[model samples]
Target: MPRILAIDYGLKRTGIAVTDEMQIIASGLTTIPSETAITFLKDYFAKEKVERVLIGEPKQMDYTPSESAKLIEAFVEKFKNNFPDLPFERVDERFTSKMAFQTMIDSGLKKKQRQNKALIDEISATIMLQDYLSRKNF
Candidate 1:
């Protein structure tokens, strides 16, 4: 029972999340520079067992691909080339950021703490992972 990883990809920063081995919980892992995300993931995978990777796919209100999608696609292409054995899936990321912000607020985080973009990113990834888990059976 390997864990499933989720990625909220961005041009400057990337958010990461991972599920427990039992696939019952998804938690924020960390945020890293976009340029270093692949190397980071490679190192992480070498240390941990990951069943698959779910990347957040940004979309416009009309369901069209967002401008940031090109950046994500490029990164996904390189990631697949680098880790051919690992499976990858895309999850709709609409409103995840807003949801993350609300989560921070509900958690009683201070204004300054909630303003941290890295924290927002990580939480966004967590939300995306949770959404995927809810829709997936088992």
Candidate 2:
């Protein structure tokens, strides 16, 4: 089976994650500058068989779309124009960042390591992918 890719998009940086070929495990792929996200994805698609893409959908506590949603939506439009053949979905990403930080703490990462925003973004993508897998499985 082809892998499913997940993206945690931010203003400056974007995180990427992908499922195993068997679709059993979600793993962090990389973090890249938001400006290069499309180029990075194009290269990635050339090398991997990706079945779908999942983008993190930011939301407020009351479930309203967050301010960042506008930027994400613009990005999605560009993505669709670039990869019209690839289908994509948006998954709620309310606390994935916080969760990633907690994960770092639980794993005993040093403060300096935990301060790496790129690492946090990558972990957030992984967490988002894992959450999607869990929901889909049950």
Candidate 3:
């Protein structure tokens, strides 16, 4: 069994999450600058067995590409070039960030704590991974 990695790609920062070998749960890994994400993933892959990489695909209400889709496309192309053997799957991530923020508020996070968008991004990655896992099980 290998881990499944998920990415919540953003223009500034990218959030990362990973599932255990069994893929029963997803946990936030970290948030890093988009420029640094590929380097980090390369190092991570060297030490861990990753079965698949899940990339969040943002969509508007009309089911069209969001503004950030272009950046994501470039990022994916770069990833495929760098890690040609790795496989990727796209998951919708329209409101995962908002959901993560709400979860933080519900958990009684202070205003200062809630202001950490990086954390929210990581949570969003977790949400994406969770959704992927749930859909696979069904």
Candidate 4:
């Protein structure tokens, strides 16, 4: 089976993750500017087949849509229109950023590395993909 790709999209940067061929493990790919993600993904898909997309869905503590929800919604809309054949699943992105930061600190990331919020976003994307993979799939 081909890999499943996950994306944590932000205004300034987007983090991409991918599952192994067996779809058992998820790993962070790279953090890239949002404007370039579409082109990158297009080229990637042209080279490699992707099964589905898992995106971080921004939500508030109470499970309500957060302010970032609007941007994500727009992105989703564009995604749907651009890639109608591909399916998308959403994983609530609550404290994934916080957890990412914690992971980085614990992993011994330098102060300068920690300062790059894109690193946090990449880790967050990994977390989202891992969490989704832990669940039972139909």
Q: In model 4, how large is the Cα lDDT of residue 45?
A: 87
Q: lDDT scores for all predictions?
A: 0.95, 0.97, 0.96, 0.88
Model 3 TM-score? 0.98
- The root-mean-square deviation over C-alpha atoms between each candidate and the true structure, in angstroms, is 0.9, 0.6, 0.7, 1.4
Q: In angstroms, give how far residue 100 of model 2 lies from its true place.
A: 0.2
Task: Give lDDT tens digits, candidate 4, residues 1-138.
Answer: 988888999998999988888989989988999878778888888988898999889988899998888888888888888889988898888899999999999999999989988888889899988888888364
Worst 10 residues of 1 by lDDT: 129-138
Q: At residue 124, what lDDT does model 3 achieve? A: 97
Model 2 Cα shift for residue 54 (angstroms): 0.3
**Model 3, span 37-121: residue lDDT tens:** 8999999999999999999999998989999999999999999999999999988999999999998999999999999999999
What shift in Å separates residue 79 of candidate 3 from its native position after superposition?
Answer: 0.7
List where candidate 4 sits over 4 angstroms from the true fold: none
lDDT of 4 at 6: 89
lDDT for each residue of candidate 2 in 71-131, tens digit (9 for 90 to 100): 9999999999999999999999999999999999999999999999999999999999999
Candidate 3, residue 37: lDDT: 87
- Model 4 gets an lDDT of 0.88
